[model samples]
Target: MRLYRMRLYRIALWVTVPMALPLLAAPAGLTAVRAARDTAPEGAPSVWRPGVTAQPVDAGRPFPALGAASMALRRMVPRPAIVSRAQWRADETKRDSHAHYAGGVRAVFIHHTDTPNGYDCADVPRTLRNLYTGQTRDRSWGDLGYNFLVDKCGTVYEGRAGGADRAVVGSHTLGFNQGTTGIAAIGTFGPGTPVPAAMEHAIAALAAWKLGLSGVDPTGKVRLTSTNGKSRYARGTSAEFDAISGHRDGFATNCPGEALIARLPAIRGLAAEIQGRYARAVPFPRLAATPGNTHRG
Candidate 1:
């Protein structure tokens, strides 16, 4: 009987010791978790905070491969037809081809072709070819500088691949190339000249889609300047908003036209509303705004 009692006591001691060890380590483990949570930055997403939302817009129409929700939200401001494939091919060869882009897209840059007045009536393909092969080539650029081109009829044409509902990197500006997408309107918008309503709607829809895909907010206000090392709008703006911006913001040339530049604030406001409506339909966090007309990363 005495031997049996002693053996039971030993077994009890072993079990208790292991149980106590976990209790002892619990506090330390908790402390580490809290430290990690505290050090994590806001706006940036993490596993712990899955609720942290990016852009507020939906990525418009879905690519058949991506899914129904992956649709890109391209609304026709007007029914514009794609230029003939033959014309597009002819333009490609007649134009100077440069480096093809192979990077993910993050932002959109809008521009005006700066074509002379009355040239708007010229053949769209020929004009685009001249711009890509003639003008930009003369300046030593690759292909046409824009990823997408909008003609006077408000038709949007694919200038580069990876533009349809995917992140594509194309050459539009220096220093801002890595994560930027470029769009150019065929005609110039200046004082006394206005963009067509269809064009505006198309731009708004496309911008909303891009903003949603990039996780940026369409409604967030963006300041045009940067201070210190941080963007002033970064904290206040939504990441999901499209960085709807002009070419002059990055380069010296006025490519987006004076009239269009002046209309950006209104354009942004319209885009934000479109995105907000889309977000409400699907329910996502409103995107935060960033400083400057463009997104840095």
Candidate 2:
């Protein structure tokens, strides 16, 4: 019999069918299943949904997600309190996949630390240090994946090994790390958990600076390829995404959570404003047309 899977606007299938064949099944059943699987269209989400558009993914670097406007890869916003690896007192005992490098920044992904949010502002250093220890020692990542982290009081801590202004590739967003930066909001923000206003502004500032580096508008959207089939998107999928997006947009997790995700539009707008301010501060050279040449030189 033909099968179909249904999807809601913001929801996934309630159950996922196992792809592996059952060993206890009889030969006749196995043969029928194999024939059905082989007959399904390529890149189908599953045998049950042969016609639904399955999200694509890729194992290689994802394509750059950019907006309508293009700009030079110049740093525009000032680097905020980017705590270095040494500053975070990271434990270098863990091993991980080698660092990946990106040519320039294109987007900023928002995330949540999934940790407590009640620490004093002055204790941010310790919090960051602990985070580094956990990610490196427990998770076995070479470095903390987030490019920067924002605390409830609006304090921003630099993450990973590279300099804050550099296009440091991160492991934060599964399948879409290249050409993007990750900013983790240090708290589990669900119902009743108020996202801090200062933290939101800090995130906006960071997004403004990072996206501005690649001439991207925070309020715009860009295309990115998915490298991990396990993510919300399938491998080889080229999806257009907001320049400022939550981790959930790229992966199958509740990172950046509901509260932070709710504030993304405002954050994106504020980032655009910050970018505009920076652009105005540095005026571009006016090209004048010479008498002998029709082209402005």
Candidate 3:
């Protein structure tokens, strides 16, 4: 969606450090999860819907040190805690017959939830749960559209039911979901409202890991075909986009907002660094495919 730029402003605070997982210091009164779960259909893929527990796990954990030999040969992949679908109370009552899997990763799309930005970091799980409810129950979509979500505090949560490491097709970006992954920031970002440093880092780390899986460069560009005329490109049109791009790049919407969109360059650079883009690349990982282009999702 197209978002008009506004001249509003908000003071931005940044905590730029090597974020670790396992334990984190958090603000008080942020210890509640507000969502419910219902039984999923039989034979459906398993979901880890344990409900939101406490604070979210950090998605910017450093990658394990590659051995001296491996370091020079292989790219480092960040290990973000893609909080499983089960972690949040995913009510799969409306889950579709199956999820779609892309052949491989070619690009990454960024987006914003346009939701309230004043929420505490701890409430992210509940917010995501509510979002899933709306998408599946209200909108009648098969599942959450985005592949992953990043909270204001920089935590990454798994969005769709497919494996986070896989190029799982999603409903996000409409005609451009195939061969791409959608990452939505869980807050509205207007012009001049500085995007949080932690959130940016998380997005970078995620892009690095996902794109690097196929040796794709975040600083590079790729050609994607548009399947819907409603999008910025007419159906069957091939458009070139930065490896890391905003939702607005493909569709005619003010998605991902100007503030967050502006930070995409830095995010792309950081993601490249995380993926060791400057160094020699390694072979792409091999994964078995589940036939069928139509992602029943």
Candidate 4:
């Protein structure tokens, strides 16, 4: 009887010890984890800071399908534009194309292909195709990367649009494609060569018209300051009105060239002017006040 009682006591002790050990260890482990999380550095992502919400590429209604007036304006405005051939082929193959229309237009982003200047914009289709097929060994990407390509002749070509105002994904910049329209010039621009006046004018006009349709003020000023809180661009300017921005603003690349970026102030001014004109044509809607009623007879 004594032996049996001792054996039973030992078994109970073993079971209880195992259970109590976990209870003792769990709080310490959990406390350490909580402390580590609390001590994490700033900018480091945590459960509390889940990072920025991804912008929607397609949500709102697109601009009313290009109308006759819009079409006429596009044609009348003789900014030399050409759509690349590879884009046309991609459209045919039904690859990397958007089936749905884009939301309201917001901003315009400009880029340069960094290709040789002598390359003809007229042959842009062939050039893009070659680049996509790996024929151009030096370049990356399988197809034309831009939504619109402006040639040296000041002509504008359509790119990657299956339908009007569609949200076609582009490889222009990281974290900027949402709610932004990208326009690329065919050749590289740098210190020696500035973007032609005609090309600039065309881009301005296109941006202005799109902004007008979207009911956004293109002339609004914007100030892009440094991470250290120092003003990079001038202050009191509408970044939105300054609708024109370089690719380097969001990413690390010398795209759109320094000369082109230098002209941003003037370009933004033009956009603002256009916005003023459109505002005059279409006045914004005002809220109506409700009338108070007295006792009725």
Candidate 5:
């Protein structure tokens, strides 16, 4: 599904069979595929409040259903809120023409954008654009490396060009990217910085829904093959990883930071609870619409 930016995906599939295996190879010729429509973008933030506390779970990170159009993750849990690439105005023209797929996701890699966390919730769209330029033009990664991004306000933005539901391979981790999804928190979360509870829950819900598509338990371990020697493992080496892992686990960089890393257990717990692997999560109530709230399951 190598679609050009601004092109309408003409071909669409209602996937029923579980697609867990060796990922499908992209076809030589360009063929468009229509995916499930993404949720509408939410209204821009009305104001910028520095160091503002995020909304609580019952109010902030509400679980939005993906509707019936979503590809079956083979689970019944509600999909987390997701803002599409269009919502963030991704410059698909800058997208790396070479997109890859991993069939189905086996795990998720967490990262922090290493940027300022004091940004206004309203400015997240602009923030995403800046990240796009840095990664594609400056870093030569071709596109935003993250498959999805989360703000302190708990909003989720679609990162790469392909549909969020699809297993579009991202250039996030060095050797451990294949068969996994990359989710970046949109702020610097070094030590002593308090992680927003909303952000953590949003990450958990997203991870739980995505992993549930493959019938994976967020609290469990997964075997992933490293594709780069520079990574902790040599190429083709099979390694064990927590279902939700920090970027430092695969690469030598202190990307997600120690504080964020320490919260992995709680995030994993929340995700597992969302998936009904443990106690069921709190029932999601319909919170009034806020400025930066929006979903794909």
Candidate 6:
């Protein structure tokens, strides 16, 4: 990761935060997933459809007290494993090698592929390749627009050519791509649609690590300037946005859909908690003087 000189201190503090689950494994169902063949299958015949009502995760739980030293400690969480372009078997020859790296990441924007949600988790690699063709061939983009893409089952796929460790600029969000990460959820999430709990968990985890790198608060605000008039903000206009924002925030589109957008508040708090910003360093309710509950000190 080529970090800008300005974030040195923040990056230093980012690694020292205390984690409740230091060695936590990848999200449920991710460990068992393996990439499909490099080429798209003739037809997907095995889609494991899920229930309509989404089960909630820890993000919905109440947060602990704000530790006085939390800022100094920084928000450090384990980096989620990202299946690289090669791992997903992207057609390398089709993409142009133009890369744009940013100084640091200030925010992360959420998006949806606008495709059907009843996809087999096993077909993710093929889906990624198809998405690559849509953008590179149909949309004429040099490469995939999203910096990262998460599936319904919580598998994280690395999009774009640049390494996930670096601040690679993407063509997502029209005007807010610079200094921000575009994380597209790999299915359409419209009204009445259920967003899987595992998907939310994975997104929150990834956002925590990415924004934590630059010490950006997931629940806070960031100012960004627009470069394209196609966006809601005119070119050169500066706008303030949440550190974790929806795709519609900067553009005139119904993307990321209503269902996923509704979960943004919980996602922000969860990311904050993961970074230790909203987690407790001291035990709650204070230990009693009783022998069973007393502290050694």
**RMSD, each candidate, Å?**
15.6, 21.0, 22.6, 22.1, 17.6, 19.1
Stretch of 10 with least lDDT, candidate 2: 32-41
How well is each residue in 1-297 modelled by candidate 5, as lDDT tens digits?
A: 356532433322224445567845434322332221111011111221322222211122223345433223455578777888887777789865555555467789999999998888878898899989888776666578889999988888899766788676677887766667899999998998888888888888899888888777788788776656778887667789998999999988998998899888888888887787755333333222223553222
What's the lDDT for all of these models?
A: 0.50, 0.65, 0.70, 0.48, 0.71, 0.72
lDDT of 3 by residue, 108-195 (tens): 9999999999987776778888898887777665788889998766778899876788767677776677678899999999898878
Prediction 3 global C-alpha lDDT:
0.70
**RMSD in Å for model 1:** 15.6
Deviation in Å, model 3, residue 6 alpha carbon: 85
Q: Pick out the ten consecutive residues of candidate 3 with the lowest summed lDDT.
A: 288-297
Residue-wise C-alpha lDDT for candidate 4, range 1-297, written one tens digit per residue: 999999999999987785533322222222121111110011211222222122233222223334423211221222223333434453334232222223335666788878787864456565455444441123322224455766565556565444324444344544444445667876788977866665666566666655555555555533221111122223222233245677777555788998777766666566555555443322322212222222111
TM-scores for all candidates: the values are 0.54, 0.67, 0.68, 0.53, 0.70, 0.69
* Model 2 TM-score relative to the real fold: 0.67
In candidate 1, position 13 carries an lDDT of 94
Query: Model 1, range 168-228, lDDT digits (tens) per residue?
Result: 4445654343345677877878776776655565565566666666555554433221111
Error of 4 at 243 (Å): 2.1
Model 2 has an lDDT value of 0.65
Q: Of models 4 and 6, which has the larger lDDT? A: 6
C-alpha lDDT of candidate 4 relative to the true structure: 0.48
lDDT of prediction 1: 0.50
lDDT of 6 by residue, 1-297 (tens): 446665876777777875575544434543232222111111111221222111111112223234533232345668987777877788898865646555568889999999889987777888888899988777666678899999887878899877787776677877677678899999999998988777887888899999988788888888877756678887668889999999999988898999999888877877787787765332222111111111110
Clashes of each: 28, 15, 9, 24, 4, 0
Model 6 stretches astray by more than 4 angstroms: 1-74, 279-297
Question: Which should have the higher lDDT, number 1 or number 6?
Answer: 6
